[model samples]
Target: MSRKLISSGSEFERKIGYSRAVVDGDYVFVSGTTGFNYATNSISDDVAEQADQCFVNIAQALEEAGSSIARIVRVTYILPNRDDFQPCWPVLQKWLGEVRPAATVFEARLLDDAMKIEVQVTARI
Candidate 1:
C-alpha cells in the first residue's frame, strides 16, 4: 500500500510539519483541524460556528483523500471548555448523526485561545 498526504493550503502544516490528512491502504486519517477557514484565515468566536467549520474542513480533506464525510468511521472532537460542547451538538448532529460514526469529545487546551474546537476523523477509502 502506498501513502499519500493531503494539504488544505494552511501554512501551519508547513510550519508545524503535518499533513491535513494521510491516506494509507484503505484508510484516510484527518489531523486535528481547527475552525480557521484555510482560505480566509478567519475563525468565528462562537463554538457552534467553529464546529460547523470543523466539519467543512474535515469533509474537504476526506474528499481529497478519496472519501467523504459520509464515510467517516470515527471522530474525535477537542474543546477548550467542557461547557461549550453541548452548544455544538446541533451542528455535529447535522453533519455526522446519520453516519453515526464512533465519536468522542474531549476538553483540553488548544494551541490558540481563539480556537474553540478541533475535529479529527478517520474514513475508509
Candidate 2:
C-alpha cells in the first residue's frame, strides 16, 4: 500500500516540513497538534481550553485521514508545566471518556511560551 499524507493547511507544516497526519495501511499517525485555530491562527492562553482545542484539532486530522477518536490506540501529551496537567486532564477525559487510549503526559517547553499543551495521536481504521 502506498503512504498518504494529510495536511490541515497549518503553516507550521510548511515551515517545519511535516504533515499534520500520515496514513499507512490501517494506521494513522498524527503530529503533535496545538490549540491554535487554523482559520484565525490564534491560540488562547487558558490551559483547559487549549487542551480541548488540541484534541479537537487532532480529531480533525484523524477524520481527514479516514479515522476517528474512537479508533485511537495511543496518545502522547506534552505540557510545558506539570501544574497545567490537572486542568487539562478533565477536558481530555470529557472528550475521550471510557474510550481512553494508552497515553503518556510529559513536561516540556513548547515552541511558543503561549502554547500550554500539545497532543499527538495514533489510530487504526
Candidate 3:
C-alpha cells in the first residue's frame, strides 16, 4: 500500500512538518505524542493524568491510521523525570494491560517543561 499520513490537527504538525502518524504497508508509525489536551491546548501537572492523555492521543492517531492500540507492536515512553515514571504505571496498565506491546522508557528533557510524558507507538494496520 502507498504511504498515508494521519493528522491530529495540532499546530505542531504544521510547524514541525510531521504527521501524527504515518501508515506504510502493514505498519503504522505514530509520532512521539504529548499530554497536551488539543482542545484546550493545556496540560496537567499530574504525571498520571498526563500519561492517560498520552494514550488518548495515541489511540486517536492509531484509529485514524486504520489500526488500534491493540495492534501496537512496540511502544516507547519518554519522561522528563525518572521519578515520574512509576506514577504513570496504573495509567499505562489501564491502556496497554492486554496488548502489552514491547516497550522501553527513557528519562530525557522534552520540548516543553509542561510536558511530563510522551509516548510513541508502532502498530499493525
Candidate 4:
C-alpha cells in the first residue's frame, strides 16, 4: 500500500515536522506519545495517571491509522525517572495484556518535567 499519515491534531506535530502515526504497507508506526491532554494541553502530575493517558492517546492514533491495540506488535516506554516505572506497571498491564507486544523500557530525560511517561508502538494493519 501507499504511505498514509495519521495526525492527532497536536500543534507540535507540524512544529516538529512529524505525524502522530504513519501507515506504510501493512505496518503502522505510532510516534511516542505523552500524557498531555490534547483538549486541555495539560499533563498529569501523577505517574500512573500519566501512563494511563499515554495509552489513551496511543489508542486513538492507532485506531485512526486503521490499526488497534490488538494489532500492536511492538511497544516502547520512555521514563525520565526509573523509580516511577513500577507504579505504572498496572496501567501497562491493563492495556497491553491482550497484545503483549514486544516491549522495551528506558530511563532517560524527557522534554518536560511533568511528563513521567511516554509510549510508542508499532502495529500491523
Candidate 5:
C-alpha cells in the first residue's frame, strides 16, 4: 500500500514535520485542526465559531484526500475548557448531524490559550 500526503498550504506542516492529513488506501487520517483562519493565522475566540472552523478544516482535508464528512468513521474533540462543550456541541451537530460518526471529547489545555477547540477525524475514501 502507498500513502499520500495532504497539505493545507500552511507553513506549520514544515515546522511541525507533519502533513495536514494522510491517506493510505481507503483510510484518510486528519491531524488535529484548530479554528484558524489560514489567511490571517488567527484563531477565533468564540467556541461555537471555533468549532465550526475546525470542522470546516477537517472537511477540507478529507475532500483533498478523496473523502467527505459523510465518510468519517471517528472524531475526537479537545477543548481547553469543559464549559465550552455546550456551545460547541450544537455547531458540531449542525455540520455532522446526519453523519454522526463515533466521537469523543476531552477537556485539556491546547497548544495556545486562544485555541478553544481542536478536532481530529478519521474517514474512508
Candidate 6:
C-alpha cells in the first residue's frame, strides 16, 4: 500500500512539518505523542494522568491510521523526570499489558513543561 499520513490537526504538525502518524504498507508509525488533548486543548499536570492522556492521544492516531492499540508491536515512553515513571506504571499496564509490545523508557525534556509524558508506537495495520 502507498504511504498515508494521519493528522490530529495540531498547529505544531503544520509548524513543525510532521504528521501525527504515518501508515506504510502493513505498519503504522505513530509520532511521539504528548498528553495535550486536542479535543479539549488542554493537558494534565500529574504524570500518571499525563501518561494516560498520552495513550488516549496515541490510540486516536493509530485508529485514524487503520490500526489499534492492540496491534502495537513497539512502544517508547518519554518523561522529563525519571522519578515520574513509576507513577505511570498502572496506566501503562492498563493500556498495554495484554499487547506487551517491545518497549523502552527515556528521561527527556518535552516541548512543553505541562506535557509530563509522551508516547510513540509502531503497530501493524
Query: What would the TM-score be for candidate 5 when compared with the true structure?
Result: 0.95
The TM-score between candidate 3 and the true structure equals 0.98
Q: How well is each residue in 6-41 modelled by candidate 2, as lDDT tens digits?
A: 999987799989999999999999999898887777
Where does model 3 exceed 4 Å of error? none
Q: Rate the local accuracy (lDDT) of all candidates.
A: 0.93, 0.90, 0.94, 0.92, 0.90, 0.92
Pairs that clash in candidate 1: none
Q: Which candidate tops lDDT? A: 3
Alpha carbon lDDT of residue 91, candidate 1? Answer: 98
lDDT of 1 by residue, 1-125 (tens): 69999999988899999999999999999999998888787999899999999999999999889999999999999999989999999999899889999989899999999999999999999
lDDT for 75 (candidate 5): 93
List pairs with backbone clashes in candidate 2.
none
Report the lDDT tens digits of candidate 6 across residue range 6-122: 999999999999999999999999999988877788887788988898899899988888889999999999989999999999999999999999999999999888888889999
lDDT score for residue 123 of model 6: 100
Q: Write down the TM-score of every candidate.
A: 0.97, 0.96, 0.98, 0.96, 0.95, 0.97
Better of 3 and 4 by lDDT: 3
| Consecutive 10-residue window with the lowest summed lDDT within model 5 | 36-45
- On the 0 to 100 scale, the lDDT of residue 36 in model 2 is 85
Report each candidate's C-alpha RMSD, comma-separated, in the order given. Answer: 0.8, 0.9, 0.7, 0.8, 1.1, 0.7
**What number of clashing residue pairs does each candidate have, in the order they appear?**
0, 0, 0, 0, 0, 0
Q: At residue 8, give the lDDT of candidate 1.
A: 93
Q: Which pairs clash inside model 5?
A: none
Return the clash pairs for model 3, or none: none
Candidate 4, overall lDDT?
A: 0.92
* Candidate 3 structure quality by residue, lDDT tens digits, 36-84: 8898888999999999999999999998889999999999999999999
